[model samples]
Target: MIKAKITVTLKKGVLDPQGKAIEGSLSALGFEGVNSVRQGKVFDIELTMDDKATAEKSLTAMCEQLLANTVIEDYRVEIFS
Candidate 1:
């Protein structure tokens, strides 16, 4: 079995309204050190694989297909033991 942790986030030029809201709330709570915020989506996928290469390939395909929007989002994946 293999585990994948996928993170999907808006591209740098894209605006993140949810992240901005969180930043506002943090500031209101006196978190003056908070400068900027960006929200991201996370996905955990588990699958049976014969080897590491297969696991990585499957994880990449999963991210490309459903975990991220290729037009305006960036995605990263981490494999866990």
Candidate 2:
């Protein structure tokens, strides 16, 4: 089996209202020196296939097709056995 860890985040130059809100709240709560904050999503997927290449391809397809919006988000995939 293979475990795939996927992280999805907004592209640079794109607006992130949720991240900004969290940053504001953190500052309000007395967390200092926070220059900026960016929010992202992580997905851990377990696959029955053992081939690293196949698992990577499948995870990429999943990300492109549904997990991420390619227009505004970028994703990175890491595989572990």
Candidates in order, TM-scores: namely 0.89, 0.98
lDDT of each: 0.87, 0.97
Question: What is the C-alpha lDDT profile of model 2 across 1-81, one tens digit per residue?
Answer: 999899999999999999999999999999999999999999999999999998999899999999999999999999987
Lowest summed lDDT over 10 consecutive residues: which window, candidate 2?
Answer: 49-58
Q: List the residue pairs that clash in candidate 2.
A: none
lDDT of 2 at 40: 97
Per-residue accuracy of model 1 over 1-81 as CA lDDT, tens digit each: 888888998999898999999999999988988889999999888878758788888888987887789899999988887
**What lDDT does candidate 2 reach at residue 76?**
100
How much lDDT does candidate 1 score?
0.87
